[model samples]
Target chain A: MSADQEQRTIRCLVAKVGLDGHDRGAHVISRAFRDAGFEVIYSGLHRAPEEIVQATVQEDVDVLGISILSGAHDTLVPEIIDGLEEYDAFEDTLILVGGIIPDDDEAELKELGVSEVFGPGASMEQMVEYVRENVPEKE
Target chain B: MSDLIDELLAGKHRALARVITKIEDRRSGHRDLVSQLHQHTGNADVIGVTGSPGSGKSTLVDKMAATYRDRGLTVGVIAIDPSSPFTGGAVLGDRIRMGSNIGDMDVFFRSMSARGSLGGLSTATTDAVKALDAFGKDKIIIETVGAGQNEIDIVKTADTVMVLVPPGSGDDVQMLKAGILEIGDIFVVNKADLDGANRTVQELREMLDYSDGAILQSSGHHGAGSMEGTDGLQIEAESEGWDPEIIETIAQRGEGVDEVLDTLDSHATYLDDSGERERQARTRYAEEIRTLVREDVNDLMAEELDHRGGMDAYLDDVVTRETDPYTVADELVGPLADCVRDRRKE
Candidate 1:
């Protein structure tokens, strides 16, 4: 990485959408991002797609990590993506999905614009490295 | 840069966010950006809410923002969280409690980290407030990183400062007697639905009454009284005769939020009527100037050290007792002092 890129702090937003009160995974990932020297904003549980998108745009974060174990990623992730596109935030934000996902749905989610998905037992190091490699360069 | 400012002034949320980023990072030309924003400020009523951890500051602020929005006022919120002193990273979770204003574009909420600021607020916070103010937000709320006695810098930013006290913590009330009591324009007993809420309120009221009497007695004596205000701004506000209000709130259920809003409105009127607002602004501007100059001089001193073959060159001499720290400081600053003296003579 260039010196400038290394110096620029990556801002990430880890959000739990749609009534999934189970936030242990979200808290763990947020800590992981902080340890990796990135500023992470955790959107507390039971957020709507529109709320997540609004936060993403207003925060101007580099990465959007949506943690959903409620098995509703198919319905919610697309709406989040659509909201981001509507606000012109999709192009700059690299989206990552964590929690349960069927293999078929994972591919379709990626087709919609998710950069990566982490299933259960994914290493913290792996998620951090993926973000370092994939986050879009800030202008 | 001008284009970015134009976009921000045109009420674009993305541009405002980007400008705030520039301010937070201290990117080149940020000072210029903020300077240009000065003319557009002074319109928004800035309210600062601070308390201890889990004191329901976020929940109360969320409800307050929603209340203001319901009243047809545009709102902007800047919630501060502490940065990890080791890694300079932060997990800002204040947005979670702010679910009330979620899909509303009129209510803009952004989170900030302390970024190694010991005062619990970095200079970026003041500048970010300016950015939001310049963007035409009617009400701007600054939620501090849970405050301790020394973390009273919120007084320098907000028009009216509200300190939240959780119910049943008599020790918490005593803790406030140190620094926060003098700065708070209003004290809120949040989580009023909890046990011992009434007792907490009574303790707070007693404390405020004691402080009020102390301030009144001190002002009358001018310089002879023990409770003479340490902060000039506080003295000005006290002399204006605006007593701090203590109110109870159940923030989680949005109860007592309207009363909080009413208190804020009355405080605003008091500031305007008493001319304390103008006095506070003057003091704030003076402090801002001093802070900026201090930072610039520190940067220059660092560069001067580097130019003198780094601190190692001086360190060895000091370590061997060949030169004392005072002597080294004098040697390093001598040239700059002489240059300034020479300019005065010219």
Candidate 2:
């Protein structure tokens, strides 16, 4: 592993994608990540998929979490994955989805290479443990 | 030199980024890393940009950094974002505005949480800047979270400071009047396309006129809070004047960026011509050294107290008010004073 990959600090980007004006979950999870001693960059509301990809790559975050409570997860999440690929960052970046994701859509999201899907009322502790357990080592 | 330092000196981006992370985390051995990086710094220009939250400071920084990059200068940006004390998470959205420079080999950007600090910067900001400096970035831009009285510490570290005021934000400058006026070397009326840009500029000019000879001193290179030698002091800014030029800009469209860069270059020239460059360098070194010594001494005293089991007694005395906090401090300070004297004798 490269020295950066061996780094113990887990850097994450917590973003609200789509027209989801609801950001309570994003705020909660972002704070939870930080309280867990992870370095987190909370991207403010209404960020486009391209902006999210750009932030993930530029900030060198280990995880890209999309909080879509507007029920537009399928479309926005795929676009974000595409944006990451367009930026040549898909392979190195881990994708995560949160907020209002239905049970049926979880498998599809995983097929789209999302590492995990978080539905409503999920605890911050579970999310924190998941990120710590799953964040990929840097190249 | 160790392998990581060698990689950093050879301009490896990953190594430089790792060093910055280490310093920000205060990881084990980070102090040694900072000390090693210190010798390799002093090449990059450190510029600080501060403004209220909605003043478009991020977009302004994006344009400024791009302007430098177009001149073939490598840029490293340290964007500070305030952390939520309750949750400890921060919305570091500066990268969203600076998207244009992403994926460029010549640009490096990192967003740091202020870590619950109200001071507008992370404590490790200076060390992170040094890591970038040692990594061969010609320009380092530090974009503060937002401006406030406590945020003036940026002036102590940056060579030039640009304070931004957005249009329609009336009384914004008035709120931070003295601290901002005394510290800013260049005042920018950002979002100049808005309705109140001219008004903001007028207010800033009025404040400048009202306070004459608050002119940046020769050794006042870093502005107010500078402890540097002021040998060739100019009484009036108009005499050896740098009027703290108020430039208007629509940063989103990249308008007036050249003028901003030009102002920065002129300030660089002024520092050199006024012989403030060497003096500012000395001042920065002394400040860093003194801060380090103070922290080291405090840490050593704590360790000594911990070792001798005196910490509990000290706390009990203060808690019971059996002795005042100051008196307890006085009792503990003797060991530290002796430690310093012994080191000097050695």
Candidate 3:
């Protein structure tokens, strides 16, 4: 690929926010992004809501994937939205959540500004395509 | 473009981040961004921290950055991890250890993967450092993946390098003896709470002493007249009139790390007073120019090859022994020579 095409590549940050220590999904998705020719930043495990927002903004990631398996999705997802709002990044950034989120909490999460939620058995290809389709084109 | 450059120089955080992404991706216009921002750099002191795996290098960097932050200095950290060769993926875990400083606006932390680079850093690491430098960071710490003899390229770009020696890792001592000693401006005995902490310190001090003693012993006996047979040992020449210091630290506990920062400050002062700062700057600039020239040549070669069928034809010739590889290389170089001259004219 041309260097210019490589530079215009999508940038994604896969994060584990709040007390959710489980990161197998985060790792799998992050590697998928990179293998799919995107620049992926894995923020490791056990990140706070503010830290997630700060990392997302500073890294200028087009898509922010929060993997929370701790069942605190309702509490933590809102905090992440508030963080994005506080930083005035909500309009520009696309948010996605992946974890063992209960089916009942899915609608509220989307209501809380999460664009999509991938529960158990979500395929890597599906998530990758979702992000690729969602983020806006580069200027 | 100039407006974006102006925003970046004015410390627009988002602009700085965008430029870094562009550079890291090797995107078009990255050269313009770098060339324009180049003059705005040199204000930030770049420090490199490298050690072996499980050497507590990340923790040390975290503590040292906190120390700099306490002194009201803005810190930018670039922590690198090796890419998975099989998967082209990496889990850059340094930011996890440095989670405590996540909320601090003064601190900007980015995790990087080596991206198949043989060296201990990404190809864009220095450019990223330049971005951070232009963003007004007072200090930029590049924490490289714990590397061995061949991956010390961080030494070339850093104003001062801190080589961490974890206690109880006897192999690190041996590695230092092999060649890593030359790159260090400061030696840190990390995890001092562990056993062999004192022993590690003693071993490092002994290594430094022996090397220094050997140089002097040879110089005195030969009256500084002969450059041959200095105990059959060739020491990497360092800046004259400066001694590398050794500090002991337990980074996880936040113990003894302040002294490491203090020693780094002293090293910076030494570089300024001894004129080594200018020398280091010149070395980095020269390296950047050489790399750009090489890239330009590669671009011309690629264009020529694409126009002439492709690599398959050349490889088919080599495979069938129809033509020699050297001849093919010469044919390729024949077109590149003029293109290089034209580039110089431009």
Candidate 4:
């Protein structure tokens, strides 16, 4: 990598929102991002939407991966987006949701500012490539 | 001053975060930014908390920050996790354990990756502390990447370095006898609710007693705590007279946190009374200057090597024994040495 490219390394945050105690998937994706040469920050399980958004802003991550398994994506994801909007971070941040996201709810989530949704069995490589290509350039 | 520094000094959390990111990434102008921040520092109490993984360093730091907030003292926390050496990437999960400061901008928690630094702290950690100090934080806590014996770098960054030992780890206590034991200002026996808590504390006390004289002498380098130089005979007494303190706590329950806070305050006072703070600052500034000069010279040498057609150009000659590695090094460094020598003669 060029010096400039190395300095501008992509930073990603893997977050678990709400009362989802299952974190094996979150851990898996966090490791995947790390192996992809992205600095990954994992917000452990049972985080509130506001808490996750707060961390996102503080970390200034290029990608925010919200891993939800509790089927509360409809309520929790929007609140997180709203929190990011409050800080004007929603636009600059590429938001990705993973884990048990239904096809019916995927469209609504993308409409609500989520960049993409990866259901079960979505290849980690595909998600990694998607983030590498889609992360927004910093000013 | 740049707008970012201006905003940071004006107490904007976003600016502080951006400043730290710039420092961590080593972006252009970060050196200049840190130079500007130097004048605004020395007000905050910098503390370092480090221990082995699962020793509850984060839990204790969270409680410490929350307690400081309750006392109306603004706080900043920098938690570090190691990066993957192979990939140059890291998964920093320290924020997960630091839930108390969430949504409270006053705490200003940031997670940093070690980024291939062998010392268990990112190279930018000192500069990040400067950013927080310039932002007017009252207490700045640095939580190091938890690699037990290699955390001596924490001494350079913090006034008080607390090493936490999980209860029932008799082996862990012995491990401290290597290097971590030398730099610790306060030894915390965390998870005091565990079965072997008392035994752990006893072991720590015994160990501290055994190392009493050695601690006073060797601690002069980094100013671990009190250990006032014994009269004029001992040159090592740059700090106040402080024997390391041992405290036990169940960090998960906030047990014994008040004592930790009190010990921190007492250490700070001791630093002031003994005039060790100024001495420590002088030593740190000297080290920082040396480090910057060394890094800059290294970069210059790399550029010079490239100008001389790089190392590959000399490879064939060295392989055939027509020229040796030392000769090549001397040839590369010769011009710089000549320049210095000529300047001295002039």
Best by TM-score: 1
lDDT of 4 by residue, B1-346 (tens): 3888998898767778788878877778887898899999989999999887899999999999999999999998888877788887898878877877778878888888767633314347889999999999999999974464445675457999998988777664465555677788888888887887777766666666567654423332323222232221232244347777777777888877877888889788878988988888888888777767666777778889899898888998999989999999898889999999999998
Residue lDDT tens for model 3, B1-346: 7777898888766677777777766767877898888788889999999888888888888887888888999999887777666555555667778855878867888876665533314347888999999889999999885565434775557899988888867754575554767788887877887888777766666677576654423233322112122311123234365666667778898887766786788788888987989988888788877766666667777888988998899999999999988999899997667677999998
Report the C-alpha lDDT of model 4 over A1-139, residue by residue, as the tens digit: 1111136668998999999899999999989999988999988879988898889888888899999999999999999999888876788899999989778899999999899999888999999999999998864
Candidate 1 CAPRI grade = acceptable
Determine which window of 10 residues in candidate 1 chain A has minimal summed lDDT.
A1-10
DockQ of 4: 0.47
Which candidate achieves the best DockQ against the true structure?
Answer: 4
TM-score of 4: 0.88
Off by over 4 Å in 1: A1-7, A19-22, B117-120, B171-173, B214-240
Q: Candidate 2 lDDT, tens digit per residue, A15-113?
A: 887677998888888767877867778777887776676666556677888889888888888888887776556776778898777778988999989
Q: Please say which candidate is ahead in DockQ: 2 or 3.
A: 3
Model 3 Cα lDDT, one tens digit per residue, A52-131:
88787677788888898888888888988887777656777788988887767998888888899998888999988998
Candidates 3 and 4, the one with greater DockQ: 4
Spell out the clash pairs found in candidate 1.
Answer: none
Pairs clashing in candidate 3? none
For residue A34, what is the lDDT in candidate 1? 97
- Top candidate on lDDT is 1
Candidate with more favorable, higher lDDT: 3 or 4:
4
